[model samples]
Target: MVETLKSWRKRWLSCGDTENLFRDNPSNQMQGVMQLKATNSGMPMKVAQRIDVSKFMSYIKVSRTQLNHIKRLKQSGDGIQTKHVSRVIGGLDKSHVKPYGALLEDEQRRLREHWLEMSCNDLPAAFEVLRERKVLMEKSIKLLGLELQQKNVSVLRKVRCDLSFNSFS
Candidate 1:
């Protein structure tokens, strides 16, 4: 019985070339490879990947005020919901069913107008503006769950930068 158990254990533990296991299953194989790489490097498992919000905003032409509203929402300890965040940041103007959609749409229109009028010569500054806008959008999404309308208004009152920077240098 002892010898039989030992033999079974060795067979189960052996890392042999099992072509059918991974080769036949693409997703499983990729997962196996990722697990192997992660373990070998002693890296912590990454729960979420970093999104390049700037690139996404540029593609969608999301406005700065819209971004600021999102940020204010997030900072007030409102948990960001993925659906609303996606809608606001990605330019999918879905009816939110909540009262906030009308207010958000009004602000978004102003931002669109602002973007149309602005021109920047400095690439880095322009990139920063885009980056900041993305940050605000992300934060706003985070805030959506935490604050009431009055709280949202108070939180948003503070983010009063022009967003239009004329670089002297």
Candidate 2:
């Protein structure tokens, strides 16, 4: 058991942890990529590939600390303002940034980057906007159809009334 633990520690230190973890956990890998992009907006994946893992880890540590502080304050019934949460989560990207900054091969990095670009313009917000727009368009079309149906019903009622009066006369 001790030897297994030691081997795992060594593997983690040598930067083998990320591949082993992310290979099976696509959700975690995606979160890491999202956090990287959030922290450094408009940063190309090629640039992200060159990021210093130690520095990235340091930033994640600090950001996580700040977030914990905010969480503690909120739990203690302290009047933690939105500014505090935003400062840690939005400004630091602490909420989304996962600890998976190991170096990847060029081909892997390129493939991930290409997938991100093709699917979402490199940001999830773009996909969200498209989805929302589609929903709104569908709603509007349905509403218009309902309005037309109502108008036809009213006209039919009026025509029936006229035909009855003429037949009686």
Candidate 3:
């Protein structure tokens, strides 16, 4: 219907659409967040709250409550990277100051301020898994070839033995 098309377009064009079509769509929300974050000033509370809800679109989605937790490290103070907000934290914190580092707990983290800015959302986890699978498949194929060769050799030996015995007979 014409109404459906209009609603769809509104959702695509602006985050403030009244129909709320994008409320459940995380990707769209992520985009809205990015746009809002890029403004010269901080985003209005309404926009920040909408982007926060997007944190739930996927299993890894980060909720609005947790947004500020990571903000401590961001230089721009815009928002967390989309992928980093996933269900799990998934890795060591990017900070260089470890527990053994000479810096105090608070001071150590500040040391990583620059690195945190560099840490925004991006993921290679899934690709790394696929890479491992490819390696395993290659190894399996090689072993299968060796087994086939051994079987062929054994069969040839049996045939040769039979041929010599039949000749004598």
Q: Point out the higher-scoring one by lDDT: 2 or 3.
A: 2
What lDDT tens digits, residue by residue, belong to model 2 across residues 1-169?
A: 3544675587678775585732666786577667765777755565444356445552233456776887786887768887876766565543444454432344489888899787776467777899999999999999999999999999999999999999999
TM-score of each: 0.22, 0.29, 0.29
TM-score of 2: 0.29
What's the residue-level lDDT of 9 in candidate 3? 81
Lowest summed-lDDT stretch of 10 residues in model 2? 98-107
Task: Score candidate 2 by lDDT.
Answer: 0.69
| Candidate 2 residue runs with Cα over 4 Å from true position | 1-123
Q: What does candidate 3's lDDT look like per residue over 1-169, in tens digits?
A: 3544676687677766566655688996676567655662554554456446544432323345655655653555765675654422434343232332222435567767755655542235556788999999999999999999999999999999999999999
What are the lDDT scores of the predictions, listed in order?
A: 0.61, 0.69, 0.61
Question: What residue runs in model 1 are displaced by over 4 Å at the alpha carbon?
Answer: 1-59, 83-169
lDDT of 1 by residue, 1-169 (tens): 3544664467556737544323456786577667666667875666543343322332234468768867876786867777667756653454233334445577799888777656444566788999999999989977875667668776666443322232332
At residue 1, candidate 2 shows an lDDT of 38
User: What TM-score does model 1 achieve against the real structure?
Assistant: 0.22
Distance from true location, Cα of 46 in model 1, Å: 19
Report how far off residue 162 is in candidate 1 (Å). Answer: 69
